[model samples]
Target: MVRISGEAVELANEGSLPAQEVPQTSITRSQAVKLYISHALSTWNARGYEFATILFTASAYPDTLVAAAIRMTIVYFAMILFSSVVGRWVQKSPNRLRTLLATIFVNRASVLAGAFFWLLILSQEDLIGSEGRFSLAKNDTLKHILFVVAMSFGIIERLSASGNLISMERDWVVTVAAPSGRPYDLTHLNAVMRRIDLVCKLISPILISVVISALDSVRIGVVYTALTSMVSIPIEAISARRVWDDNPSLRVPKEVPPEGETPPLQSGTMSWRTQLRQYLHDSKMYFSTTVWIPSMALAMLYFNVITWRATFITYLINVGYSLNTITIARTIGSLFEISSTVATPRGVEYLGKSYRSVPQDEHESEVGLVSGEDSQSVRDTRTLVGLQRFGLWGFTWQVFNTAPVVVALFAITAPRVQDGGINVFASRMVDRAADYTLPAPPVGWSIVLFSFLAISRFGVWIYDLTTQQLTQTLVPSHQRSSFAGVETSMMNIVQLFAGGAAIAYPKTDQFVYLASASFVVVVLSWLMYASWVYRQRGHLVHWEKLGQGLFVGGR
Candidate 1:
């Protein structure tokens, strides 16, 4: 029997069989709520712009995805286990305020630490990229080893914390809405806001670079970029508090209930586990009708595209530069700020709000449905955020590789094109936009090849969200962390394997082929999401299905 969730795609699968009335609603909420959600999802441009630049300029060969994945999994599991042990230590003390204060302090510290860590990570990457002469000194080897290790740890921590910080935005938006006034559920206005957020994300880096260029140096931009993480942490942290502690929706009064009365428990008592359980239980309703099938499978496929292309860039870059010989205080600024820039167009609500605070009024439907400011936001955010998961990895590798791609493509496509950053960089100007124009690179359809890579990735983003949500909905909450952990671990594995492929290939062509494998896997993964998820919509299959699909496709 056909199910409800996947009905949209299933109907599409019939391929123009007949035009039947498919019911959809418009005018679900006020313009403001839609605006907020759209803003939050708008980071694609910022991230994509960075990827464009990185791909255009990149130079490193990739590492082994298998090795990197395994290492990352091990580290994360260890950290999770450790957090369980130490979280209590930090939370100690009977006073709830004090406990919250302590937790907030750690939260603040993480953001600060993240900034510095991020700086170091970017600097190391720049070192290997900018260092010329293509040397492999003893020092270079040591630095390479250290750079990988640092990046692994640094990214893990940065990403993990960053995820939580972003989540606060989801949670806080729910906390602040006015009661009795619910926003419409699916407004295009939300999408419009998302576009704005992206504008900010894309333009900020170039703006920062312009300032640095004015000084004829990259270091000032880098330092300023790194230091700004300090500002971001607090802003986001308070936003988180608002959601957790201050949200009117989640807030509970301390007054004792009457003997005949009952009230909702405060968030202090409810757990992520409980929230997770309820989510899973409700997901059973839509398992058969999931629309995420194509998008999910595509995501895995796109990851592969990025692997070989970006990795090849990294390997070549490392070969030419010694880690310590190069400096990149400017790039760090571009890295983190880009997210904020992208997020702006996605949602104005995301822009003005922080993840810590939630002051939204709770509007409970007479029937028992809990839909409000954040719920719709969360739903849309989950759907769109997948577009950006690769921002860090893709942006760093791709934008950094831009010069070479242009040169290579120009070489192949326009055979006589001279290769070099100055030349290739200058050619990037559609208008005399870049006053400090570089020389042009000969031949290789650099633009065409890179465009294919980006378009494929964008398709994957659209696919992953639908499937991820459906899967998350079907699974139980207690199992989500483990599920999430496994999924995350698998992604790490993919990256590790890509890295290995980058190194093993004797030539760039072979490496690119290896990268194609990622896309192949992604396509296959989506097929499964669509077919299997559609087939089992109304019943529970072996939880084992998930094990096989965990890392099937991702970017």
Candidate 2:
């Protein structure tokens, strides 16, 4: 007779999968506090930005704000050169805290020193000007110097913040999910994203507008931004620990990344060529050098000129609306639309788990097998497949995809900028109150432009949300920090060039140019929608769910 003993019971239990495995990572709460100081170093918002706006509108020269641009360029150049060096210097070293401490010192401590010295400078200026012994020239120089120093610290911190966050996010995500099994299913992970999006959508627009306005104002904006970072960074860093539970995978860095390896390639928008380029390339500046390689080698490569037009138009619409509203709104909206599993815990349980893994034989479906042994691999692979295909949008979001187009826009308009600029044609008419004794023609023109912009904001809001999500989801988690940071750099770079173009831009027929661009952008939308469908056409599994089981519902 077969007799079961305590040893048999122990053996049987040992054979079973874990009830729950929660893992904790080494990126501890203390380290998280230090990591965020980089934000203060990296952001370089100049004081008196409103003043600069007025000056730029009235004057002919590159203002002190442009100096802020130069400083940003220098900082990034240093960051690009030094990131790996910094990465190495701190890699597995106890002195990683030293780097964080140094950034903090430069950002927070140096401000006190500069403030004291600048107060002396201001005292001298006051005495000299009061005595009628000073020129506006002396005061301007001192003011500019003080402003640049404060902003430089800000820029350095912002750069460090981006790198710091990326590092934390990567490590934290892996640690949190380590207990689930061989492969983590993102569908199970991102389901909670919907609530986040909903909350963000409703809350962000208002909060962001306040944030931007406060950031734009005097003295208060800088302090507010620094304080916000202090709070937000710590929270973000700590939240990662919750994901990993009961897994042996949680601890210090190991030989392997948690998500494991990429599966062998099947069909994807990413060609072998693009993959090779992305893998081997350093300094994402080189990313674009290869997009043309495939096009040239292929017999038929069609250009989507309309898509390009639509994107620019979309971008215009985005900024045309209250940028503060769009920035926060879009961020929250994108967060919400992301798969609930990837975003929330309750979302995962509700959307992902089968109430009964063993379904009725008559109701047995392809999904029923998701709980089986072999089924894990298939489900995991499908999620990865779905995740990886997002690289198409990723491909578009990267430097190689966007640089040439922006450079071309700059090149086209760079020659015509004249001194004092074209007065932002629409702004010229709108800034003056309608009742404030303006010419009849000007009043009428202002009304039309404002009306147009008001109607356009809604469309712009939608596009902004879509594009932000596309950027976030399309990228691999490992590379997203640098990639997202690069977008900011691209915006700054474009604006710098655009500033010069704006200076030279003549006022003649300004509305004509604006209207034409806007019209072209709207018309191109349908075509862009078509291209999205075209790229998605061949994927057999990518289908819209038509019935109850087809649609994913979150908790």
Candidate 3:
């Protein structure tokens, strides 16, 4: 006797069906693959552009190393400011997709403009007199303006890339399904994306090198920029279109909670002060999760180490290593990264299973699962899993992975070592030749150093994957964006301070010592915090079988 509309009938039928038996309206497998490809291409283009910009800046400036570092600091600072504003706007705006698309367009336009300016400057080399050239290199005012404009564009490009990543994550949550008609597991999806990302990283540097070689002239770098932009921008637009068309409901503005209900944190209607407090509170909660703060600290240290490596790369180029050779080395490193990426998911899974029992039928909660009254035991299991996964020894291994670079830098710059007395591994490897150019180190030493770099790179990649998985597990759905934004902002602030320190003491020894001391302090602090966590939760720990299935003839 009840009057039911067609929609109500559909809903009633849907509710009657079992979860797995119900058909889902989600993205097709082909569409998902295409989106992944687009993401990789976008990352490639951005990295290529950055590489070109660094080389261009170094070639144009006299104090190349220090200038590039300063320029990088400015870019980081700009991205921090821009992302904070834009992220808030996206969260609050009714038209998120449109705003995202418009931002992408603006980022591409800025890249084009920056490329044009670089071309203009490079092409005018013959026309500029000696005085003009000197001014171009040494005039602080002109140099500052040029770096600011160029880096601002870079910041915009990075922000746009981040927006795309967030969109992709959201799309997967809302619209993606497993090929077997089951809910998508974030761990599996992240593994696939990481492998693709590694493959992209492997190919992008070689492609960039080829482009640079083909162009031959710095002025022609603009052509490469335009080409990459054309490829990436169109793909992004198409992906956005597909997302909207395939998931029409995503376009609908999210409704506010009823007036009587408790308002969600970070709601658009909240006062600015309220929002700030919420952000801080959310950040604290997120970082307080077992081992997250230290894991994050190590990640930040790795990022800071990269800037130091960039400065080192500039030094190498100044002292006669061709840019091509450096690019080739990086490409080789990426090959190793592919292996690391492939192993990470399995490693995390093994550790999780070994340390604690993860529910096999819990894919729904795997994406944005949070601790609840009924799930408190599960949360405890996950907390113990994290503790065992990245306890004191894990943190130490991560620190050691990247410590060799600092050691190598110290050996190269220390006065005693510079005098060529240390002979255990050929002090000449660190010594400057008579011509003031650094000589190629012995092949054995080169192998050791490159091995260190490769291992460090692998460790960092694993850490990144682990942090992401933990974040997905710990953060609730409603607070994900707020937490993500706060974490990102905090990382940038830390990097800015680190970058400022690097700029202040541009000398190799000074930089290495400061970096080493900081790294040690972070690792020790993490170890202490980890000890405290272990004490609080140690009683929960239990032994579990390993290699049981394989040995027992089980599938």
Top-lDDT candidate index: 3
Point out the higher-scoring one by TM-score: 2 or 3: 3
lDDT of 3 at 30: 59
* lDDT for each residue of candidate 1 in 139-174, tens digit (9 for 90 to 100): 435544544554444434434432332222222222
**Per-residue lDDT of model 3, residues 1-555, tens digit only:** 011122212322221223343344555565666656656666676667767787677655644366677677777776555444444444444554675577567767878877766654544433244544322333545545666676677777777766655544533333243421133344456656777766765666556657667866555566677667766888877776676556544555533223332224443566767655555554564464443554465445533544325655644454334777666666667766676667654554444444333334342133112223234334334432542353433345456855676566455444323334553223334554533334454444445555666665666556566556544434442334434555566677777776666666665435556556555655664565455435433432333433342232322
The top-ranked prediction according to TM-score is 3
The lDDT, on a scale of 0 to 1, for candidate 2 is 0.33
Q: Model 2 segments beyond 4 Å from truth?
A: 1-138, 178-217, 220-250, 254-281, 284-373, 385-555
* Pick by lDDT: 1 or 3, better one: 3
- Candidate 1 or 2, higher TM-score? 1
**C-alpha lDDT values of all predictions:** 0.35, 0.33, 0.53
- For model 2, how big is the CA root-mean-square deviation? 13.6
For every model shown, the clashing-pair count is: 138, 47, 0
